[model samples]
Target: MKAVGVVVEYNPFHNGHLYHLRESVKKSNADIVIAVMSGYFLQRGEPALVSKWERTKMALQGGVDLVVELPYAFATQKAETFANGAVSILDALHCSYLCFGSETGDIAPFLHTNEFLQKESEQYEEYIKHFMQTGVNYPTALSLAYQKISNRKDTLDLSQPNNILGFHYVKAISKLNSNMIPLTIKRYKAGYHDKDFASTSIASATSIRNSLFDQNADISSYVPNDTYTILEKYKEQYGVFHQWENYFSFLKYSLLTMKEEELKSIYEVEEGLENRVLKLIIDSHCFQDFMEQLKTKRYTWTRLQRLCMHILTRTSKQEMNLINQHETSPYIRLLGMSERGQEYLRSIKKNLKLPIISKVSGFHHPLFEIDLRAAATYFMIFPEPLRSRLLKTEYTTPPIRMSY
Candidate 1:
């Protein structure tokens, strides 16, 4: 009953994801696969194409034995924090291995990179600080710093998105001293940010999402049958797929009503960003326009979007600070599980490091409360009857049980 864990968002489980899942199972040689998935929102600071529940069904149908929700505090943060939370949960679950999709595809490079960085941590920090002070974004600063110290061809290229995340996954495992062995699978044809369909069958999630929104394009060929079915079902029931533009009006309202001091209290709102948002919010007509005006060399679009998402959900800096005071995730929240997954959990339940949450009624952690607020805010984009119904599901919907 060995288990392999993967940190995923499954924005809408597609062919590339299916390939990764299958490949992970083969590579890890484990009996079951467990996924730590994002809820409501994604790491890029965008709302998920569908809710977590629907995505859970997709995961189960696509072959994941278990699915756990990545708390909002970690899911929407940068790569380092996101990996720390996700990897810790897998370790808590007592997974034997962690499998991730990366550009490098070789586990050796990630190990080498982590070890090199650890030995050169002081010099790396100095280089990062020097780069950041020159007006480059954080990701850019990291890439520059890595290049400055490590010229070895065997190390991962930090500039690639999946490679960056995979490196952090390795770093987190070492930091926690977890027993899980790390594995990697090369990503399929399409790139992470690919906007158009690059392959006939192996399209990126970004391309699939863009097609879905741009023309209501049929994505059946790009995803598994169950994933396609779930996508259609979600859109049919919710009337529209979730996206940032859908919540633009509400975001505008939030910015309009909140005072400068209040906006400044939100997480990631720093360095006079509150004032800049206050001044620009009124003149902007849409989310894209507002972002364009607010975008600066120092702030990446992803970072800015995350800031806006925090403002929209009223996620205060104090709340995040309180949650961060703890070393790892406060709890492991189950979203779905198969028969094998249930059996595995039962075996490990006694030895589990974190409490496993099947229902939210008795839970009272600050991180859990942020997840609740995020759920509430996410459903606000819907019309009245639908909004109330969807919001109620946040508490009422139990972890999905599946047989296969």
Candidate 2:
């Protein structure tokens, strides 16, 4: 009855993701797999190509036994906080192992790097800040500094996206002294940020979303038929991120109209990123553009995006800290579950510590509450039928697309 946990944002289930899930199950010899996924927004600081429930259903159909929501606050955060949030949830669930897709797929290197960094990390941190003062991007500064201190100049580019996120997972596990063993699956194909579906079977969510937006390029190959059917039903209904311009403007106005001191309450606002955000909100054409304008050497895009999302959700530093002190994940909310998943839940229901929620309004999690509302709000932006149906949609979310 051992469970393997995976933290994901299956914006749209794809072939590569399916491979990862299957490999994870086989590698871990897991009886059941639990995936803690982002609700509505993705890590890229944009609305998911599809809704959370849709993605949850896709996960279930795709092979994951159970799908749980990673609260919005964590899902849209920087790598460190994001990993912390996901790992904490998996640990809380008493999962025995974690298996994530990685470019290196070798845990030994990450483990070695983790030990070295842990034993001698203060110097690296100092070096990173020194580079930051020179106007290097935070991630680049971190990479450059780590290389200098570790004396692995040519080999220590751990800052590449997946590896960076992986490092955080390792760091968190070590810092927390958790027993969950970590494993990595070699990524099969398609780079994460790759914007086009180069192959018929393997593609990134970015590519699929791009297809959906372009109104051309057959997406029949990228997603499962079920997903296609779902997309067809709401193709015209879902408002793409581009359409969220008005919404972003609303957010900008909200920030600018607020008192200066009030802006300081938002997380990631230190050193006046808030003032920068407020000033540029009007100058930029869209959310992405706005972030570009606000990004600085001291703050990375991922970090700035997290800050922007926090602002949109009104997650204050005090509130975030208060919530963090009380609950990393207050309750494990099941988005969808297969029959096997249902059985697993039954077995762990009594032994588990946190409450499991299956509905939105029942949650008091500040971030969850906001994201759920935002999800509905975003759905409402879509035209008539979808807007109306998805507004109060519950389990109507269909099964995941796993039949690749």
Candidate 3:
């Protein structure tokens, strides 16, 4: 069976995502489209606006043939590390292509840029160090280094979120030298950071989440009917939509109570950030305000948010280092699947490079433990009734299987 892979968060799967999934299948001409989706938390260093199970159901309903978990270690990291884990999984699955939505739409530039960076690694590193000495953020430093090394004006565009991630996907593929082809689908309607929900059929997930959680605006037109229904169910049961803001008090408590040494032990905590967090926790009123007080050129809001989340979950550097030592996912944990997806899994089950985890009881890895903690963390803010029912241990909750 030919399978095309996508690395996604789905975070509630809006209309734009539905469009991309259909286009990916059409463009790849594959039998199955496998999605490796983030669990609980997202790459931007924030909790998802909805549960992963709900999002997985949305993906299956929308168009994904199969879905697998992208472990928390990689899911919450920077773009490069996130892409590395995702590409590695797809390569292990022996997918034919990797398709992703991008602002540029064209794949030529990403390929060219990846090749250039690979060929000039030493020079690029030197430039990066030089720029870092100026106290700019790593992304800014990397962007400046790329423009310097490539000596192309357009190379600066690599800094855009989608473009940056797409470039990393290509780079990871090249690094692995896997057979999978890389492709891009042009993003439509709203831009990645565009917070306004337009009247168009598609809107960014950011806009939809903001509308649902912040303004309580109607987002029926921006998402599929099934998605709307699922969201409404969550709303009635859980009050407002689940978001990072909902966990602010927990995060603040974690921050205020954690020792400096303990804070330093968490992943992404560095450069005396532990000290800064301890100092600022007292003055901050909420998550948004805490983030504002801590934001700086050296630390992006996304980076700080991720750090705060790590502290809340007690995700330690030692744990992540152990994962790196292992070099790949311990198992492929199925999230949800359609009929064709089931067939695809069966076809590859015999020759799989990693263990297939259909039952959570079989998991003996620390990474899976982290995943469980993350899920539990997500439910802490949920209303009691919904929280009780929804907080089933991973062992008890089977993957969502959709029959025709």
lDDT of each: 0.93, 0.74, 0.85
Order the numbered candidates by lDDT, best leading. Answer: 1, 3, 2
Please write out the lDDT profile of model 3 over residues 270-383, one tens digit for every residue. 988888889988988778888888999887888888888898899999999976675467677788999999998888888887887879875688888898899888888866
lDDT of 1 at 392: 97
For candidate 3, the per-residue lDDT at 30 reads 91
- Best model number under TM-score: 1
Error of 1 at 43 (Å): 0.6
Q: Taking the tens digit of each residue's C-alpha lDDT, what string does model 2 give over 219-317? A: 777777766766676555553533345357657767778887888987768886667776787677777688667876667666776666666666678
* CA error at residue 240 for candidate 3, angstroms: 3.1
Candidate with the larger TM-score of 2 and 3: 3
Q: How does model 2 score by TM-score? A: 0.87
* Candidate 1 lDDT tens digits, 163-255: 999999999999999999999999989999999999799999988998899765888899999988888887777778888889999999999
Model 1 misplaced regions, further than 4 Å: none
lDDT of 1 at 229: 84
